[model samples]
Target: MGELRLMKGNEALAEAAIRAGVDAYFGYPITPQSEVIEYLMAEKPEERTGMVVLQAESELAAINMVYGAAGAGKKVMTSSSSPGVSLKQEGLSYIAGAELPCVYANVVRGGPGLGTIQPSQADYFQSVKGGGHGDYKQIVLAPASVQEMADFVKLGFELAFQYRIAVLILSDGVIGQMMEKVELFEQMPRMSDDEIAEKYPWAVTGKKKGAERTIITSLDLDSRKMEEHNHHLQRKYAEIIDKEVRYELIQCDDAEYIIVAYGSSARIAQKTIQLAREKGIKVGLLRLITLFPFPNVQIQELCKRGIKGWLAVEMSAGQMVEDVMLAVNGNGKVAHYGRYGGIVHTPEEVLQALEEKIIGE
Candidate 1:
């Protein structure tokens, strides 16, 4: 309820997950994100809340464990960094296809290969546009600070269960390792077993003596049934897009330029915005909290409001800028700025881009 103590981003995320009544955690130890599993291990919630925590064989096994537990209608979660997360994509696709509820924390590190153990928001498309195959969308929560790491875990789980979907807490290594103050609630309210079963009756638990055996699976022998299932998932995604668009508008009242960013990149953009204001530049930031929904409507509205240029500042090479362009609808100039392979851009760098792209122009 009140500010409690300083905690690392990964540690806070684990604590918040425990408080959120997560039933099971299955994950392998990966750099940066390993602290999340270590926190759970050290805290040992089983003594208090009867939670299940398993250090799995690999990220592959961990994601499958999430699939199994989520199929049972229990709140479940797992965590990994970039390469580790990439390993779990097949399982993630299965979870998405099955339309199960789970939380996956991706403490993003360098990419394209086993690049480095530093922060990078390079997985923007992977998190938002479906890391795995098939037409699907995950509820991606982009957390900017250590406190956000704690907060988004609970919100992610709630949204996942509510929408019958997977949710991703997309953070980065710097955000993961940093120590910051966070107020963790005493406990989070949880739905009862009866309530869960009542709400998600399709979950596979063995049937009674006379009842039919409930099957929970993404597989359909018939192509038409599979098509129907895909249609249902698409409808759910459409509803999420309509209802779950979330982003922050900073000083856009009469802004001449809009800086679009999210996750840790958004924090850097905030500093850039402050500097821009001090320099008498009428720039604003639209920090997206929900990456999947993409907040296209906000960007579109800003473009309509005479924002001459939009800067897509990210930690990677222009992944989200594609969406920004789509949202701008060719009405204004959209430019991309970033440093990839685990290099996070500084506020000065972002401001420089803004200056060169907007002011100089």
Candidate 2:
């Protein structure tokens, strides 16, 4: 364990990047997340830990830089908000197709276009459902707190390299700007060249003596080969689904209702649960930690336990509710409550929605 300090989520993420031994960070400035790169620059991680940080002109260039560094078997990362993440979709698709490992964080703001600088979970669909053009998936981790904002950087990198796939940390403006006490982890040294070669033999580094040169690309001219590649990706996604479903079940025992939420919504739902309980309403919360490998099985099992109803709370217009409905499979009624365009639902509002939309009915 390292020292505990009060930190903002964005700053925690930057410090954790340094401790996680990231080789490079290439990112463009975006609202609610610009603090990430700003902190990195001010810290001068290059002097402290030999980490390289560069500010790219656009999200497109930043993600492409990440692709290049990751293909060469280096630990790299980037961060942006919703629109910027939208711009990086092409590069993300390329990274996924090439099967390179890297980390990305989207400190999301409200948006379909330049929505708002305020918090939102509207990007849930985009993050989990392959925002890029491909039959591929990236591991998506939703951090509900400043601690998790820091912790997920290392965890995301671990999973990315472990599976040779990209990992995304999905956060919102509330979590990004909120201050909280967080305990940091001990610093880790960056991987050596030999270690990288041993771990990622297929990386696009220079060829070894008599070894075939490695090619990092998503292009396959042959249709059959591309089909086979897609199948391979499917297998990887299945493996991740089986092994990495993470969620938090709070006050679930004997509860009659469950509230499903992730990221900042989870925090609000927690308060809603408390308020509901005070009124003698048996309410519980299911906090999703990994959005990509969604805890579907767990949700299904909870649904089987005969809960009366469910409320899927989010900062968007009921996006994640679709997943909850699918998981419930009509076992019970499921409703959605949300505020869009950067308007976050308060605990009172969530509780009211619960009573009117779910409990009352």
Candidate 3:
């Protein structure tokens, strides 16, 4: 346990990265998330913990820097908003193909283009469904609070290294900009060359005496070899799905109606549940913490328990609802309610939709 302090989500995330022993951070400035790098620069982790921080010329350059550092077996990270994250997709695909471990955060804004600087979960599909090319998956974690914003950085790094895969902390403007009390972790020292060698033996660090040189690249000219690599990735993803499904079920016992949400929407849905309960409506909430794993089994089990209906509340039109429907598998009716273009839905609006669309019908 560490000291508790009131902080913004972006600041918490940056402090947590320092405490998580990140070796380097390479990122470009982006709205609702610029505070992450700004804090890192002001803290001067280079002096405090020997951590390196650099502002890249562009998101493309930042992600490629991450790829390089991660390939060298260092704990590196980057952060950006939606459009910037989109630019990093190519680098992300390369990192996944090379099987490098790193953490990235997308403090998302509303988007199809350079949407708005306000909160949005429209990037859910992109984050979970392989935003870049190739058949690959990145572990996605959604934080509903400033505390989880800090906590998930540690968890993200742990998972990234454990599976040798990229991990995404998919937050939005609401969570990133909101202020809250957060308890941060203790400071951790950066890893040394010996530590990296012991931990990531296959890393493309310089070869030891009599040891074979290691190469890190995603390029495979042979089709059969590429297919084999894809199969291996699939196996790794399946294992991650089986082992790392994380979510929170609030007031679910004996409830007839359920609300499915993640990130900021989960916080809003919590209030909706309270309001609905006051009216004697039995409603519960399923808050997804690990979005990539999807928590399908938990959702399916809940659906099997004979819930009347599900309403997926999001900041986007209807991205995550598709996953909810897939999990429900026709067991019950599922509906989606959202506000787009940088707009956030109010708790009252969510409750109203729940009543009209799910409870009333």
Candidate 4:
């Protein structure tokens, strides 16, 4: 069994990174998630596991470090909060365009600008839909608890290298700062140079005599070639949506109404489910795990099962609710309730919104 400890989500994630065999971490300090690098530095993973942890001057510099290391076939990651993440979008897009394998975490706070240090899910659109330019989507893992904050790190890196893509652990301030029991995974040995060269033939290792020299670039001036590359990315995304969709259903087997949420919002909605059920409201919850490979199929299945209404709870104005509506496709009543710009809603508020928006309506 792995060691169990009560740890904050960000620290748990850091521990998981070292254990998951990440070769490098490059990140700038940002609130709610600054602990990730702090823990990494304090624990001295460099001494323990030979993991390189560096705090870059800015988010742009940090992400470029990840890109450079990942291009050389090293397992790498970074973490930042919302505004810092926004600064890294260009680098993220470049990484995605190059089809490099890496992972990053956005311990989300508020935003449009520097909104608040408190939690918010307003980054949902940017994350699931592709925060940077171009038609690309990161495999987003929304962790609902401290346990998942640790677990998704392993899963994120796995998915990243598996698909040759960047993966996102889309967390929030609450999950990042909140302390809870977490099971730390066993330490994994970092892949040897031979192993990386063998596994990632596309990686930029030293060109061997008569060996194919790897060329990594997102820019293709040739129109048709760029189109082909775009098609390849689209196909990759389609495969991910098909094969990697993940979610959770709570009290949904026989429920007539569904409350859709993810991450910290889903945690609160769990409590809302209990309250609704106690009041004889037969409410259930659909918690999204992979927000990009959104459980469209599952939502459709629930709709077919005659789920009467859908209430979407989030820390956004109404971003994820649109997806819920599209998934429901006029089969049920759909409404959204949220406190955006860094305000976190409570279980009671979620229940009341469900009553008025879904039930009372």
lDDT of 2 by residue, 1-361 (tens): 6879999999999999999999999999999999999999999999999999999999999999999999999999999999999999999999999999999999999888998999989998999999999788999999999999999999999999999999999999999999999999999999998898897887887897898989999999999999999999999999999999899999999799999999999999999999999999999999999988988889889878999899999999988999999889899999999998899899999999999999897
- For lDDT, the strongest prediction is 3
Residue 81 lDDT in candidate 3: 98
- Runs off by more than 4 Å, candidate 1: 189-195
lDDT of each: 0.89, 0.94, 0.95, 0.94
lDDT string, candidate 4, 1-361, tens digits: 8899999999999999999999999999989899999999999998998999999999999999999999999999999999999999999999999999999999999887999999999998999888899999889999999999999999999999999999999999999999999999899899999998888899998899997789988999998999999999999999999999999999999899999999999999999999989999999999999999898888999898999999999999999999898889899999999998889998999999999999997
Tens digit of per-residue lDDT, candidate 3, span 14-79: 999999999999999999899999999999999888899999999999999999999999999999
User: In model 3, what are the clashing residue pairs, if there are any?
Assistant: none
Could you estimate the TM-score for every candidate?
A: 0.97, 0.99, 0.99, 0.99
- How does residue 263 of candidate 4 score in lDDT? 92
Instruction: Itemize residue pairs with steric clashes in candidate 2.
Output: none
Which pairs clash in model 1?
Answer: none
Model 2, stretches more than 4 Å misplaced?
Answer: none
**Tens-digit lDDT string for candidate 1 (1-361):** 6659899999999998889889899999989899999999999888757778999999999999999989988999999999999999999999989888999899999888898998898888889888899888999998888888998988898799899889999999988999999988677655567776777887875566887788877788899999998899899999999999999998989799999998888989999999999999899989899998788887877777889999999999889999999999999988999898879899999999999976787
Between candidates 1 and 2, the one scoring higher on lDDT is 2
- On lDDT, the stronger of 1 and 3 is 3
